[model samples]
Target chain A: MTAVLCRHFGLHHMDIAEDIASDTFLKASEHWALNGVPDNPTAWLYTVARNKAKDYFKRTAIFETKVRNEIIPESIENEGEFDYNGRIIADSQLAMIFAVCNPANPSESQICLALQILCGFSVEEIADAFLTKIETIRKRLQRGRKNLRNNSFQITTLNETDIRSRLPIVLRTLYLLFNEGYFSKTSSKQVRIELCSEAMRLTLLLTENTLTNTPQVNALLALMCFQSSRLDARTDIRGEAILFDEQDKSRWDQSLIQRGNYYLVNATDRQEVSKYHLEAGIAYWHTAPADDSKWTHILQLYNQLIVVEYSPITALNRVFAFAKVHGKDKAIVEAEKLGLEQNSYYHALLGYLYAQTAAAKSIAHYEQAIQLTKSPTEKRTWQKEITLLRQDKR
Target chain B: MKEFALIFRLTDISDFQPSPEQMQERMNWLGSIAARNQLVDKGNTLLPVPGSAKTVKPDNVVTDGPYTEIKEFISGYIVIKAATIEEAVVIAKENPIFKIGGSIEVREVLKRD
Candidate 1:
């Protein structure tokens, strides 16, 4: 609602737009408590917010002149009616996302602003998502807003060129949002679901619009759907993290898997393949029943993924796949070549591979893994591995 | 149900100037309480020290106040309908002020007549 109001009253009046939005919620809270919530809560909120904005303009002479001259169109003002529906709200949100993703701001600031403004993430939630301090998140948000204001960036409909360049950042932000949800340090299931679902929701918005219905968008959506399908199996009944190999396949959501397949098919319609396409393929393989064929396919996809977009985590994951395809020794050699000694996952994989050969070496690697990670779950898993290795040695 | 005032006390944060996003979260928090029919008054934010504050002495001499000697001041207060002080405290615990290291005091209101 705030985004739409800002769109209506020029982005420069973001503060006013925010004030009006806050007032709308305040009014809703007071009124709803007295008289039960209205039948159409959203429409009710929209009407109240619009009226509040109108009142704001009427009372503030300066805003009235500014609205007339620079903000709302004269035709819409002459009509004395602001007709709004769900589509307008969605467009406003999309425009807000683009404005937040302005190339002027750093990528981190762009992601932080998008999560805070578009997804309604709290500062603390964003900080948790990014694995950063609350103060750092606050500073990023402040810098992002100041950059937006100084640039006088408006939320406008983008052309193809603009969309092509800006859409990647938007996709990257959503990807990170989803990853944060999937692998958050917090033990709360609700927070993880909220983050992942919010990311999927925003990505769905892009797919719905004609301008943004690109192959890469579909691929990312497919990737999220595939990953989300396994969310139920990602943890044990006690809420402890479950390794992918140990997860129960029956717990996975088949419907979501089907939906993922649908998007994956659509994603392949274009000749160009993005990193999302490769990741989605890898995710798809994970959904399949455990077999040598699936592991071989996954390893191939990882090979392509590394060539296209390399990250330390991805490289570590590839090593695990390499172990399945070849032997533990070969996988260990490849993992060591990456030189990610500081990464807990790297050490954990090495420990697993070494357990198949030398138990003493495996214990050392497991100890390193336990020492490198701050996550209690990871530490516990590595500790268990170390105990198992020692028992075997004895 | 009885009415209680949830007074927000804290060091001045006016200089911090919370971002719109932060303010929106606060409004959402207050809105949730109001939706539950507990909020009696939305309350107002107090001006910072050195702004429109005066302490009148017993002799009717007004002195510029909100003394800087004190580290904390009551920044705002919201009246809420609760069955007991405990209930009010539960509600106050959810206040956004705590996120910024502020504190809340839940005191019952004395009914007149």
Candidate 2:
């Protein structure tokens, strides 16, 4: 609703749009506390926001005349101008995505802006998601908004070519958002779930649009659905992250798994393959009933993913699949070649692989892993593994 | 309920010009408290350092103010009604100044008999 209002008033009046939105919420809280929530809370908020905007315009005649002459058409002025429908709201949000992801701004700024403005993520929440300090997130948002204003960016539908060129950044932003939600180090599960749902919702918006409904988008959606299906099983009763093999399969959401499969099928319809396609394939294998054959298929998907988009994290994850497919000794040799010794996960994986044959080396790796990681939970897990290795040695 | 003044102390490291998002978040926090009728004063941000400031000394003598020797300075203050000092501390903790490493000193406002 705020995005729509900003679009209507022109992006230059973002401060005004934000003021009206905040006032609407303030009014809602004051009124709802006295008289229970209205039957149609959305409509109520929208009406209050519209009235606030109207009041602002009435108070500033020069600004009102400028808006009338420059932005709003004379003919449309009489047609319930403030009555924004669902379609307009969606388009406004879509335009907001493009506006945030403008090539002129840095990628980090774009993601931060989208998360805060479009997804309603607080500065602290965004900081947690990106593993950065709150001050950094604040600067990113400031620079992003300043760039938008300087560029005279406004919310409007983009041409097909522009959409095609800009779509990758949007997908990348959503991908990072989902990853943050899925593997958040923060204690709050609710925030993580909200992030995941927001990412999925925005991705769904892309899939719904004609210009953005590409193979990569479908594949990304499929990957998110598959990963989300296992969210319940990913954490233990005490909210600690559980290893994939130790998770209880019964807790997985079967309906979401089915939905993931549906999107995966759609993703494969095109001849062109993307990193998302490979990732979705890997995620699908994880949802499938675990067997020796499934591990082989997962390994193949990881290989394809690495070839398509090589990242240090992806390479590290690929080593786990390699360990599953090949013997531990062979996998250790391959992992050693990756030169990721500084990474805690790399040391952790090495410790696990070497625990059976090389007790002293495994203990050393576990200690290294504990030293490298800042996460208390991860350190505790490594300590427990080291204790077990000592017991085995005794 | 007692009124408490939340005095924000700005460290030298603090960002003088906070981003718009930071400003909005601070406003929203204060707005929520105000909606509940707990706010006594919305408060004001102080002028930047090395600016026009004066200190009135003994015998009506005036000098350039804000002791340059001090590393920390009083930036702003907001008064809110709370049932106890603990409640006031909780309110003070919500101020956005802490995000940039500034500190808030909560003091109870004494009432006249």
Residues A193-300, candidate 1, lDDT per residue (tens digit)?
888998899999999989998999999999999999989899776567888878888989999999999999989965788999999999999988877588877876
* TM-score of candidate 2 chain A against the true chain A: 0.92
TM-score of chain B of 2: 0.82
Query: Where does model 1 exceed 4 Å of error?
Result: A63-81, B1-113
Query: In candidate 1, what are the lDDT values of residues B6-104, reduced to their tens digit?
Result: 887877556236676466446545644553446677777765556567666687877674655676777777788887888788778766777777888
* lDDT at A14, model 2: 78
Candidate 1 chain A lowest-lDDT run of ten: A72-81
Could you tell me the TM-score of candidate 1? 0.73
Q: How is the predicted docking of candidate 1 categorized under the CAPRI scheme? A: incorrect
The lDDT per prediction is 0.80, 0.80
Question: DockQ, per-model, please?
Answer: 0.01, 0.01
Please provide, for model 2 over B20-106, each residue's C-alpha lDDT reduced to its tens digit, 9 standing for 90 to 100.
667655654564355344677766776645555666778997766465567677777878888899988876777778888889999
Off by over 4 Å in 2: A63-80, B1-113
